[model samples]
Structure formats: C-alpha cells, structure tokens
Target: MTRLNHQEKAKEFDKWISWKQEGNKDAETELIMRFLPLVTKVANRLAIGLPATVDKEDLISFGRFGLLDALQKFDHTRGLQFETYAMWRIRGAMIDGLRENDWIPRTVRDKAKKIEEAYTRLEQEKLRTPTDAEVCEYLGMTEKELQQVLYDTSLAAMVSIDEAVGEEDEQKTARHSYIVDEMTPRPESVAEAKSLKEVLSKCIDKLPEKERLVVSLFYFEELTLSEIADVMNLSPSRISQLHSKAIFRLRSALTRWKSQLL
Candidate 1:
C-alpha cells in the first residue's frame, strides 16, 4: 500500500474509526494492514542500538497489538488525530513486551527500580527532579560510586513516556492511555545520538585509571564530590579538583573531534 501524508492518514483513520464503531470487521482488518508498516517502523526505531537479543521483530509484533488498541479507542470528538494518538500505544506495546521478555537482567532491573523509586520520592518531597547530588546522598554513596553505577548500568534507562501510555479502543484490550506529540526526531538525529554515545564510551576508556574512575563515579553513578571522596578515601576538595581536570580533558577531546568532523 502507498504511504499517505498526515492529513490523508488522518482521514483514513477517521473512516476506520467510524466503520469500527459499527462493528465492521473488514474495516478493522484493512486498517491494520494499512498501518502495520508504520507501527513496525516505530518499533524498529525504538529497538535500534539495543542489544541484538532485543529482537526488533518481537517489538513489531507487540506494536501490532498496540495498533489494534489504537484503532478501537480513538475518539474523533477529542479533536486529536489518530496517528498522534496511536504512536504512544505502539511504543508502549513494545516496552511492555521488553518487560515481559526479561531482556534486562534481574539485578540491573532491581537497580533501575530503586533509582526510579528514589526519583519519585525525591520529586514528591522536593516537587522537582532530584539533583544528581541528591540521588548520591540518598543512596549514601560517594559521587564516584554513583557514577560507576550509572555508567555500568546505563543500559537500564527507562522507556520514554511517549512509548508508554495511549488511548485504547472500546472493542480492544485496555491499553494504557498515552499522550503523543510531534517530538519524534529525524532518523539522522537518532544516528548521531548513537555515534555520540560510542564516542563518549571510547573517551571514557582512554582516561587515566584515576580520572576514568572519577568520571564514572561522578557522572554515571551520580556521586557528589564529598561522597566520591569518602569512597576513594580522599578529601572532597581533591575529588573536586580531579573531576574538574577530567571534564576539561573530555571537553577538549570532544571539541577537537567535532572540528575534525566539520
């Protein structure tokens, strides 16, 4: 099938929605066939750069279920276009699949859960996102320790909410309601982000042992200078000095690389 522009897709979606409400099975099948590629594309993008075990095709399958959900729950009266509403469901289905598949190790998942909980508590208490220092303090770890944890466990990053909640169709299963907006970045931007991550990893590896440890503990583990000092058995001032020097070196390296790229 030919791809449609957003406006044309929206019209097609509305017709499907109307036909679906009247118990039209054929319309439902047609809608699924028409939009399955879009759902698969979103799923594939979400799985990009993940471990091979993540299985992009599995995410696509999960997204198919989410697509059905979108078809059923869409409401034209809300003045929201269907594609805008469906993207979230599609992504959410993929995440739910990941969770069910046990792709993330149990220990890492536990750590991620703790981090999430800590963030939640901090938000409730402070009414804002918790600072990196606050997270270190809460965990009773030094800054370096926190950074190590963050770097080592960075793969545990939470799924974006854009891929989490969405409206569900009445005739379909009760899927989470997610708000979809037009914030999806271009594919090239996604590729650049991946390249930057690889570069950062390489840079981290090239640091002197002490500087590398400091960088890992401070940035990835989310440790404050004092906390890192405690772990390294040094004064907070010393840890701060090390951190400053490491950051300067990293910035200089990245600057040179960017200049070369340009």
Candidate 2:
C-alpha cells in the first residue's frame, strides 16, 4: 500500500475508527493491516541487542497484542497520535512478555547489577566516566573476562533502564502521563522532561570517546552492537561492554540529579 500524507492518513484513520466503533469487522481488519508495519518496525529495533536465542517472530507476535490493545484503549479525543501511543504499547508489551518468560538468567542479572554498582562507586569517587580498563580493574577482572561478562549480561543491562521502578500499574500510568499526554502536557511535566533530556545529554557527552561513539551508533543510528563493533574494529563482546558501561554511568548520573532535585 502506498503511504498517505499526514492529513490524508488522519482522515482515512478517522473513517476506519468510526466504522470499527460501530462493529465493522472489515474496518477492524483494515486498521490491523495498516499498523502491521509499525509492529514489525518496533520489534526489529528492539531485537538488535537481544540474545540470538530470542526469536524475532516472537517479539512481533507479542507486539500484535500491544497494537490491538492500543487500538482499543487509545482516545482520539486526547489529541495524541495513534502511532505515538501504539509505539509505547508495543514496546512495553514485548518487554513485559520477555519478563514473563524470565529470559535473562539470574546470574546474568546479578553480574549486570555488579557492573552498575562498580560504575556508581567509581563515579562517586572520581566524578568522571570511568574508562573500560578502570571498570575492569574495579571489578577485579581482566579485559577479556569483562568482555565475556558483558556478553552474558547484555540483555539484562538493556532491560533494566526501562524496567518499572515501582508498582506496575502506577509505573505504567506515570510513564503514559509523562510521555503520552492528554492534548498538551502540564507545564510541570514539560519542564521535567526537558530537565531529563538535558541531564541525559550531558552525561552522554561526558562518556569516553569510543563509548560515546558506541552509544551514538546503537541508539541514534539504530545500529546493532555487532555492526558497531565492525565500525570500531572491536569484537561484539567489547561493544556490549562499552554499551553497558555507558548506560550505567547515565543511570547513575540521572539518579544523582534526581536526588539533588528533591
């Protein structure tokens, strides 16, 4: 199907939504067909750093539930675009499904926590982004051993930053209110979001050059860790270590910033 421009697409969607609201099965099917590409796009992007054992098709299958849920729950009256709302629902559903499956082993999660702890301690002590060598020394491991641990813990690290920090329902509601709002966001929420972006930018900018490049390529460029490894001429495991360390530093910085705000 040819893509419609925004105006044309919105009008078409309004028609389909109205028909579906009136129990039109054909309209519902059409909406599903139209959103399938979005489901696939989210799944593919998320699957990048996931372990090889995870099936991409499984993420897509999980994402369909999110799409349907978004279609049912989304309020056009809220003035939020379906695409924006559906993207979060889809990604959240996939992560929830992965958690349900307990895909990351307990040991890997422990190791990832240990790495984060090292980052926190070092940053508090030195007030700088610790180099990979420094982190390895802090962990009392060789560079090769650090790489192996990183490979084992990569999925755990990726999931932790986005994991809910409080009661599940409350976390979901807070995230939705913060990221997806009803028409215009409250001034306070807008200010909080701006502050968060500024803190995150400064933290990322302070990363070691190679680590910064890895973060840039993976998140901004949407490149896989292996692809970034190729670009940097390092092993994929090394790239994962850099990615993990970068996230740890950012999380620590953000935590400290939030504490200072209180």
Q: Top model by TM-score, which number?
A: 2
Q: Count the clashes in each prediction.
A: 22, 0
* Model 2: colliding residue pairs: none
User: Which lDDT tens digits does candidate 2 get at residues 1-262?
Assistant: 3567999878766766676567777777777788878888888767655777889898998999989988887765656567767877888788888888988888888898898888888888888777668889999999888878877777777676665423344224222222222322445455666666677778878888987898788767768766787899997767776777777777777678778887
The top-ranked prediction according to lDDT is: 2
Q: After superposition, how far is residue 221 of candidate 2 from its true place, in Å?
A: 3.3
Per-prediction TM-score, please? 0.46, 0.85
lDDT of each: 0.58, 0.73
Candidate 1: what lDDT? 0.58
* Over 4 Å off, model 2: 1-3, 164-184, 224-237
Kindly report which residue stretches of model 1 are placed more than 4 angstroms away from their true locations once superposed: 1-14, 113-155, 160-262
lDDT of 2 at 210: 86
Looking at model 2, which ten-residue stretch has the lowest summed lDDT?
174-183
